[model samples]
Target: MPDILAVLNGVSPAWFLIVAGLLAWGAPWSPVRKALMLIGPCFALLAWFATHETGVYGVIDLGPFQLETFRFDSLSRIWVLVFILIAFINGVYALHERNRMTDGAALIYAGAAVGAVLSGDLLTLFFFWELTALASAPLIFAAGAPMAHRAGLRYLAIQVLSGVLLLAGAAVWASQTGSWGCDAIGVDSAAGVMLLLAFGVKAGFPLLHMWLPDAYPKATGVGSVVLSAFTTKLAVYALARGFAGEGALIAIGLVMAVFPIVFALVSNDLRQTLAYALINQLGFMVVGVGLGNELALNGAAANAFVGVIYMALMFMTLGAVLHRTGTVKATELGGLFKSMPVTGVCAIIGALSVAGVPLFSGFVAKTLILSGAHYAHNDLAYAILVYASAGVMELSVLKVVYCAFFGEARHHQVREAPQTMLLGMALAAFLCVYLGVDYRALYELLPFGIDDYEPYKLNNVFGQVQLLLGGAFVFALAVGFKLFPLKSDHTILDADWFYRRLGDGAARWGKAMGELLVHAINTALTAGVARLRARLFNLFNPAGALSREFPSGLMALWTAIMLAAVLLVSYFSPMS
Candidate 1:
């Protein structure tokens, strides 16, 4: 057999899991199938660990171009590690389920995302890009509900459109630049514009963002956890790779970061709330990419890294609630801290991390971006990022913890999640604290190695604490004023309303108006035809004009006079 390390060096870790995922459907026994799910990621992690240096690894020479499968560099290293970590955690989380489709689709979706991250060229990236879209759709579809079915179809359409845009942009780029490499192609060219749009579609750029919040919450509980980690982050990876430092992204990112607060405030479903907050969290990272300094890039990478864990931790906790309680809607849930104390604690930790409270993972990661914005002298953007960091994410994500676990006991008899699920949340929760407190581990994995950026400085910690307190106060004020939606049954129409309801409504209205117009026109035409028929019958029917005919001689004389008159009229006519 070939050397293990050598094999790892040459193969992308994704193949190990992708192959295993394909084989999972054929595994005759449940035990062996589940084992494959766990083992696949472990071996992929081993492959990730085995690589010692950064360069292209698996280069395929297909007739016209070379496909670089594993570009294990600093930037990709962080994303790949986090993805592999999530895959393993998700596998542990999903161990209780026996659905082969979810099992296979989740693994393949994850592996495809990893493969896309490690892709060195546009050609290779596009191939894996489409794969992720295809693989992840079934996870949403597996929810076995009409809503999930519709959401899954929309999700697939949007994702496939992103892939098409990517391929088109890459083709245009190759024509202009004569290479398929995915280095920093800025927004000055047409191809760059297309590529930014493609990535933006996935990155949750405002208006292009409906696909995320629409589908993720509607997916199966385990599916939501898996869906949360990969697709959007992959878009961030693409943006960092291609459109870093584009000034326009700063404005776009802020819009993305800020707008979700309103929707989250009114949302009823905890999972759906988290889905909106996902867009909010990603905006900060997008800003980091736009700022595009080493510090900003590192911040983006760090945020993306920890964002995965904390966000998944939050999703995992909510998923657990969904698992036991059958609903993530706030109106139908309350006060579960008694029975689900462990999950409640985990939820609180996840909330703290999301809120960027001091000594949590979010604080450590967000500091880099805030500092990056400050050092870059982007005061306005810095202020916005700071406010969004403190204000939006805290209120949005923390509500899940409060309403579901600590509010009021609407679900008293609900038991704890399965063992495997708790273990998943446990692993994710531990990382939230560990990465926050010991941020150097996360910093070291950044695209830029950890520099003099100390997150634990007196002012940094104090400021974040102050911000956290202020945000808490606002949340409390909102609650006091009855502005916070702790237990709502409302279906808040977000940007998604335009497509899901508004667009559908418009089409229906148009069809009704067209039918009305046609009916009116048909009525007028029928009336006119009836009037003409009656006039003709009155004038020339047998008992009308013909019954009053004169004698033949008088008729002949009249005819001769009429013929002379006709001849005179014809002679006078211009045409004659």
Candidate 2:
């Protein structure tokens, strides 16, 4: 095969989206919509393949800033290709959803993600970053429930704040450094810190993570699947691009790895549980980024690529459950294997992938990250990651699988997921297994080479199996003794308490103070008006002295007395 340079040298992948968006707009509920949804990715993929070399495609000089819209380097290629692949898979999954709002949002959201990854400058990245936020928020609100509305608002606030921070950081960095390139920016300067924070918010770092679980579970089924595919992964890609070697990320990653397990253990909603589990998995990638070596960076990239697939798989499976049974709560969902076998099997595959079982994509990808930690002699991070890996099995694999599919029947029978959803799940499932068995393809696409790392070695497989099976056995015992957390509808208090509770309290206090201020102003105005009215009545009434015949003489005497008093005061004044 000839290299991409020999065939089509300078092509812009973003323009293909215009065709897709136009096609989607032409028909609201026609067969053309489905065709556009599927074919759009194909056009993008063709564009992506046509460019084999790394070069800037769309460059515009804006006097003070040079905006490079398309940067086809190794780092961007890995991320953008997976994003396009995800868009196609998501399109397939959402094919059954005829809601034009969701369909349009998904396409726009996908385009924004592609635009962000391919951007070569901070200004361009900021533009696409905000577009992703603005485009994806509607997916959550499309559910049209009260909770969805509230969650969408919260999601919008956090995402927009991230964009604002990005713009601010970009301006500062450009002003200080006179460069707009999106390169590694360690948090040594104010601009770097601001950029780090901007990336941190979207990457769902420890304190900033509440929005993911809070909003994702509340979105419509198809909406949830679309939401799962893009935002956080894009953040991960940003981190890989900007802050890969910062030692601070190791501790951040460790905390990120372990912190969400508690919430996942106690979560009653399967979607919420999976959302927390997604955080746990992100921890590993963050750790990899912290390690800063080629192997570790490759590992982070590979994990992010595979993570998008598996997490979307899990969300898609449960989303199908929610669609068919009207609920995804563990208490309300059980023995679903008897009815929705296809979904159940797909969920199991997703579970295995997330739990990092051998021969699944998670195993291959997560190994590189952990191995990097171990090789770096960061024993603390290694230990935490190992423990967190087991915890992942407990919450995501055992709890999710048993609670939703393997237990006694608790509801009326329901049919299997639609053919379209199954088709989507099958594509993800094939990738999960294929990437595991043939991981070289994944590694080859990594930002770095993988010759030094071997995931399928006997020793690696043995250790992974030992930890995973041991965790499984312990989880089984815990379940037998009824030691696992019971189901409840109450929302768990998290870092969100800072916002949800304290913020709400502050808002209420401010509102009360505002009301009191308004009341005080009204009272003062009312009293002043009353006094003015009394004086007016006294002076203007028909009984006043001015109405009498001697009014002129009395008025002259009063004026003379006022003039004498003023003169007396002026005589006593020191300046006068």
Candidate 3:
């Protein structure tokens, strides 16, 4: 058994899933495809667990260049485990669907993300990084919506741009150092900045984040669930790996943490709102990355791990609603708890976890970030994050829960989510509670091993309670004052305003101006040509001076005189 396990340690968990994904495309039966979905993640998890210690376990040679394929260090250990776990849960959530393309795409996408996390060199990372983009785009296409197709194209473009930047950064770094290793790249050089931008796009950095809301909600129900698991988190992992302790990330992360709550508070689309909330959660992780102490890095990793489970849960619930009711619009949803009791319960649990209520995964993970900020002496940042979590994030979660499941009934009668979906949600919800109770298990997996950390001191617990109570008070006040706009059919305008509305308008205006300029130039050219033609006609026509016939005698006399003059001039010339 030990020998078999040792051999397993050398192989990447990613290949099993990638191969399974390719096989899924050729699978003839639905049951087999579903089993394949479960098989890949299960086997991947097994392979991940088989590793007893960390090192560069797998290397590939390409002529003169050696590629480090599997760097199973402490940083990648937790990331790989969570990715495999989510991939399995995602598989279970999707068992009711019958789309082979989605099955193949989701598995390949998950594997590609894992491969990127395990990569020890820039060249290896670049290969898997771009593979993730190519593999996941198909999930958006699987939605079959025209909007989805357009969004998928945009998503692909941004991801390809990220890849281009990564490749360029790698080339520059290699030129400078004669190596392509992935470690401790500070943002002090061009290559480092380029690499930062590459990671930022996928991490949902503030201005670069429109893709999250624009694309995820537009994908199919199962597609949305799968989409939530990998991309942004992968970027977070990259940042943690390459640029930990980067000071600029502090400011960038602060902005990411705050602004999305406003949009989430007003948006009608449940999944879209959750997408905003996703960015909000990522902000906390970013702040942790920026802080970059042992505590801070652990916070970032734990948040990412817990985040996948709860976010996947919330997405699954809304997806179930969309599945049965065909709309996640707040105005169109209500009284769903009566029928979809399991899903509604799951949503509320997810909402609590997201709100960082005590004894949940979020509370445990989020406190680490708060503590990180506090310990760093960043008083302002700590205050703002706490305020965002208590006031804004809590309020947004309320709106999601109230509007989607318990508010005044507007329309739709629906059954509970399918059995597989419930099981997936239940599994995630269980983790949420389990991780909160046993956070030490999570800490043990972090890059820096934990030592006597206390998350549940009396002061911290009471402070959290006070915030929860205060947030509840604010929610009541908003409802009583009629200030909360919890229901609408409009999607929140975000960076898409610049990318879509303004960009489309600009393109059209440019095109129209271009055509007008071309037309005016052509008209001027035509007029000038016509005038030139008329002038030529007047000057050289048969009735004109040059065209008139001359007398032969006069012409011959002129020719003879010219010849005599030319001969006299040539005789007087020195060298003629």
Candidate 4:
């Protein structure tokens, strides 16, 4: 009974979301929605503080099957806490949404996400992994546009594919190992590759990243916030659990970090640029996991934790711009600092955090990953990562802040964001500062020990500053030299090109082939039946004769013969 009570206590945080989803569904546009939004996170915070480092494991026995385990360790707690916090802030931010369906979907999405991180067994993790997809699809649909509907379908398809892969890998591992434990699998096996592919798809690893730009811009402000927090990070967590240190991930991570910078450089849409940037940032975490050292693992986990904040901050800032100025296109927006000072400042803070500027959350978190890479003695990987870091400063953090908020005013008399939105952004911004300054606490929560990490080392600080300054100088030089490429009217080809254009093309071709087959079959059947009828008619009626006259003559001759035979028979039968 006491054990049951403890489990209930540990899971209490999840119930808040359950309650919020129910209220959002049943209640109308009232304070109840707002209350549920605020109350949900408050309960999560309370639960996080109350739950201790007990290292307790809950097990359920199943005959002939592996026992189901639900355990709380230091490593899982960090992610769980972050998931809870993000869910709350996202809920508050989404309060401006008029659609109850969006609110409800966001809550369920949050719940499933939190559940995924807290899960202890592979089977449990798989269940939450799929639930997240089911819950988040509605948010994409809530955009209330035809494009959004199509994008939602595509997004759902990809997410389902990822889930299917995860389940298949889990099933294979269970059958081979006779355990459903969520531990690292050997990279030599098919199950490991399947798991990697599953995580890769979700992590937006290189070519698999199409759904991000396709779906994020189509989501509502609140929807974007929810979307940013769950899918990729969950995939990262799964990788950390199942395929950390796999050699293939190193190459995959490098591709992820480098390719997106080029797209972000040339792209005009601010939101899409950010989406590309998100993939770039995820590469750092992937590299850390591939390194497979303690510091590297810690770095990966820390990156996941901090990535949530910065990603949310970026999304919120962009979402605010879309809400106030009515668009997020770089060509359409300029100089919003005149009126929306709060939003402008918040956006800059977000930019700094993402850029890894000193004393921001990103600086502390990203350095750990880079340092881990160095510690692992993968100098080539480290060098590539350094270049990518400079690219991050150039493409996104600086470009977005300067172009969108610091230039000439494009709109006059624009108002600030709503109070709830501002509050949410402020809270996230505050956490960014808090995490940056008190990184020691964050460090301690990492999955691996990092005795050698010194965030304020002279070489580290100098290199980061040099990179940031160099990136800025390059940007200025490009502008001064008139080397900045003109924004093209055409869409840059990306991984989604194959799926969207090629997939659509394939569908059209299939339809055409099907139509041709149907036509050909119908023609052949008609011809065959016509030929058969003609042959039958010819056989019955004869081709040349219109009428037959021999039938009456033959009938008369036969009757005469029959009469002669009857007479002969009567004469012969006289004796009778």
Better of 1 and 3 by lDDT: 1
The digit string of per-residue lDDT tens for model 3 on 313-424 reads 9998998898899988887888888889999999989988898888888988899889989999999889989988776788888778887888677657678899998998
TM-score of each prediction? 0.87, 0.89, 0.89, 0.87
lDDT of each: 0.88, 0.85, 0.87, 0.78
lDDT of 1 by residue, 154-218 (tens): 99999999999999999999999999998899998999999999999989999999998889999
Clashes of 2: 0
Once fitted onto the true fold, the runs of candidate 4 whose alpha carbons sit more than 4 angstroms away are 1-8, 54-69, 486-490, 518-576
Alpha carbon deviation, residue 122, candidate 4 (Å)? 2.4
Candidate 3 C-alpha error for residue 374, in Å: 0.9
Off by more than 4 A, model 1: 1-3, 505-576
Pairs that collide in candidate 3 are none
lDDT of 4 by residue, 5-60 (tens): 45556554555675777687678875677678778777766766666654544454
Using TM-score as the measure, name the better of candidate 1 and candidate 2.
Answer: 2
RMSD of each: 11.3, 8.2, 10.5, 13.3
For model 1, the local distance difference test gives: 0.88
